[model samples]
Target: MLYIVSALKPEAQAFVDHYKLKKSKLNNFTIFSNYNIRLIISGMGVENARLATQTLINNFDITDDDTYLNTGICGASRSYTIGELIECGGVNYNGIDHIFQENRPIISCVSEEVATPSYELADMESYGFYDAVIHNPAIKQFHIIKVVSDHFEPQKVGKEETKSLLFNVIDDINKIINF
Candidate 1:
C-alpha cells in the first residue's frame, strides 16, 4: 500500500483526480483511496499532520512493503522555481534535524506560515508527518515530497495554483514511489 499525507485538499486533489480515488471519512480526516493508495488531508500544521497521520496509522495494518509519503506545497527561496519538485532528504523541526536521505534538500518545518526565506525551504507539516511515521516499525519505505509553490510569498499561492503544481509532478511522485 502507498499511504500519502498531504496538508491540504488542493495538494491532494492532484492524486485524487489522477488515481480516480473515492472520498471517505476516516475518523476526523478526509481520506481519498482506491485499491493501492490511501491519501489523507492533514490540514495545515505540524500538530494536525501528526494527528491525521496517527489516525491513519491506528486504523491500518502496516507491512514492510508499504510506503508512506508526505506530499505538499512549500515556501522556498528564489533559487527554486515555482512548480519545482523537492524530495526532502531531511527535516528540521524546532531546532532538531532528522535525516532521511542524503544529498537532497533539507526542509524546515515551522509552526506557522513563513513569508521570508529564513530557510532554504519551509513548510508547516513535514515534521509532524515525520514525527508520526518515524515511530512505526512495520513500515520501511517513506518519503517527504514537496512542490515549490512560492518564493517565500505564501500569500500568493491559490487553490488552483496548488493543484496545478502538484498535478505537474504526479509522474515524478510515482517514480519516487516505485523506486
Candidate 2:
C-alpha cells in the first residue's frame, strides 16, 4: 500500500484517472484510492499538508511497508528547465530546514511562490507533508517528487498547463516509485 499526497488536483489528476480511483471523504479531506494506492489532495500550503496527512493516518490502516510519496509541480531555478523531475532532499519551512534521506540534493523552500536562487525548488506543501509523515509510526521511508514547472513565475502556469506538466512526466514518476 502506497499513500501519496499532492497539493493540487491537477498534480494527482493523472494517477487518479489512470488508476480509476474511487473518491471518499474523511473529515473534510478528499481521499482518492484504488486497491494498491491512496492519494490525498492537501491543497496548496504547509498547514493543509500537515492536517490532511495526520487525518489520513488516523483514519486509515497504514502499514510499515506503505510509503507516502509527495508528488507535485514545483518552482525551479533558472539552472533547471521546465518538465524536469527532482527528488527533494530537504525542505526549508519558516526559516528552518528539514532534511530527508532521499539522495536527490535539490533543496526545496515552502511558500506560496518565491524566487529561485534562494532554493533549488519551491513549493507550498512539501515541508508540511514531510513534517507530518516523518512522525508516523508506520512510516519509515517517505519520498517527495517535484517536477520543475516554474522559473520564479508560477502565475504564468494555468490549469491546463498544470495538468499537462504532470501528465507528461507521469510515466517517469511511476518508474521512480515502481508503481
Clashes of each: 0, 0
Give a tens-digit lDDT track for model 2, residues 56-174. 78877877677788888888878899998887788877777777754665456565577545776788888888889888767876888888888978778887788888888878887
Q: Model 1, poorest ten-residue lDDT window?
A: 170-179
Residue 131 alpha-carbon offset, candidate 1, angstroms: 0.6
Please give the lDDT score at residue 144 for candidate 2: 88
Give residue 40's error in model 1 in angstroms. 0.7
Where does candidate 2 stray beyond 4 Å?
115-117
Question: Whole-model Cα lDDT per candidate?
Answer: 0.92, 0.81
Candidate 2 clashes between residue pairs 3 or more apart in a chain or in different chains: none
Model 1 root mean square deviation, Cα atoms: 0.9
- Candidate 1's residue-wise lDDT over 30-147, tens digit each? 9999999999999999999999889888999998888999999999999999999999999999898899899989999998889878999999999989999999877788899999
- Measured over all alpha carbons after superposition, the RMSD of each candidate to the real structure, in angstroms, is 0.9, 1.7
